[model samples]
Target: MNASLPCVLFVDDEERILRSLRMLFRGRCEILTTTSGSEAAEWVRRRPVHVVVSDQRMPGMTGVEVLREVAAQSPATMRILLTGYADMDAVTASVNDGEIWRFIEKPWVARYLVDTVEHAARVAQHDFALAVARLAVPPPPVVGNAPIAARIAVLDNEGSLAAQVRDVLPAAVRVEHAFDLESTLELLADHDVAVVIARLSSTDGDVADALKQLKRLRPATLAIVVSSLRDSRLLIGLINEGQVFRFLLQPAPRELLRRGLAAALERHAHLRAQSDLLQRHAVDAPRQEPIATTTGRLLRAWRRLREAATLRSA
Candidate 1:
């Protein structure tokens, strides 16, 4: 593909591996390499690198630690972990804690390595594109009884949901709550909340149906489905297919629930407010139906919208 390749920074303590990668991918991308993690971090701090591929077996800090730092600083930059099976725990931690997009074996083939890097570049570019989308289309408005609040419901056969709601959200929220999906949706339909905290039950209820209906009814509403099941397949399905905002494990501590819900709602409010702004901007935006192209049709749409926004701002 003739896509604009992303700037890549490859970090490893080994000079041979660095040289080999340089030989293979020198012309493929605007490549940057560092033999030390400290240098790599500094390079990242100084410039806007799109993607970082790092070896896990560094001398001082593991790949996970390095990427964690990267995630905190350059969140838009994609991360990848390269390692030769020294520790499975580190690899897993790298994937989870660092949010590393991909994990590759150390003795990778030149062709495979190239493909992996290319794929990561695509992902990094997508992340950047999504950031632009967020800029172009403002998030939805934040409307609620509480100035800063969350709409949380804990599904219980009894009124136990009240406890969950209280435990999760602060006093800033006016708890419009319920025990099941239907009641929750009724409250949600009437109220303006950034988040819906719900629980799953299989003894006599279909939790998936509840989640599906909520998403169908309110496309912009963010659902945080909680389940105590051994497997979170249903929650994952809702998130993947139904476009539910996020999911949480059931039996999570009340404090954890509070923090997670607060965060989810904060994001929800922010996205809504931004979306409303974008919608308002679109009123006089030099409108276009849609573009037909292979490369950057999506990005072009965003660029146009952002252009409109720029015009309005100016």
Candidate 2:
């Protein structure tokens, strides 16, 4: 209805189908219809399309191909795969590769289409904003005390909190003992830390991204953030995008830390379990770590990854 509202690109060679869908979604969204995938892609490149609904069986590029391109170029855009013909390989590939949020089958119901698009739009907006904010937010920096595996990584800055964590967590929790930036990275190479305990300070966007990148690399790890500054927006970014588990104010109570650690350990176990399941299924896509974990691993490991990534990028 609103011209300034978010755009949605619908691609299907079938004019009848396009017309029908347009009729259905005309008033609800700012719909742009195209008869071909290439046309859809062009539209997407030139304009900001919040969501893309493409027919899987397009003439030139299949729906997956179009959506995949959209994902690479404009990841903030929500992607949807629509088809009358459904197969496992195609579905899985679209899900894994294209990262489509929802799949709609043809002979689509008017109500379902509208509802699905609405939900996808909400997800897209929320996810993108959170991701942007996470650039400033830190992920939690602690996993758990699992004796089954050696403490490959330890994320404790040189502080009383670190000592406090050392006292409470499973003795197996490895300690990198990095007081500043440089030593933290040196420790990362030698060990595989499952948990990180970062002393949070107000830093730049790059810092938060560094934390998020580590979690992406090692989804099984935990990131716990201990901060004196409780910025709610930054905290939300950490929790939503950075995958931080727990939030503890500076000078956290020992009992609270103890309880949080226990929960974190449990979350770590669950992540491992789910990871094992995905591996068993032989899924190629990286499954996101659940947000329920207590905290992410510490700052040193988190920060070093960014430093390394920056060096590589440069």
TM-score per model over all chains: 0.50, 0.44
Give a tens-digit lDDT track for model 2, residues 1-314: 78546677889989998888888877777889998787787887887778899888878898889999998877778887878876545654564356565566778777867877876666555555555676796445435445445342334455677678778766665544566433544564445555666777764424444455556555566666676764654553453345565667778789877776666566566555444321111111212332223234544444555565456436
List the global CA lDDT of all models: 0.60, 0.63
Q: In candidate 1, what residue range of length 10 has the lowest lDDT sum? A: 278-287
Give one digit per residue, the lDDT tens place, for model 1 in 1-314.
23476789988988898898889887788889987787788888997778888998888877778888888888778777777854545643553357565566768877767876786676567667767787877555556433554555555656565577675566877666575544554455456555666666562354554455444444445566555653433432343234444444556567656666665566556555544322111111111222222136433433443354345346
Clash-forming residue pairs, model 1: 138-274, 138-275, 139-271, 139-272, 139-274, 139-275, 140-271, 140-272, 140-273, 141-272
Q: For each candidate, how many residue pairs have backbone atoms clashing (under 3 Å)?
A: 10, 32
Residue 82 CA error for candidate 2 (Å)?
1.0
Model 2 misplaced stretches (Cα beyond 4 Å): 1-4, 126-314
Model 2 quality (TM-score): 0.44
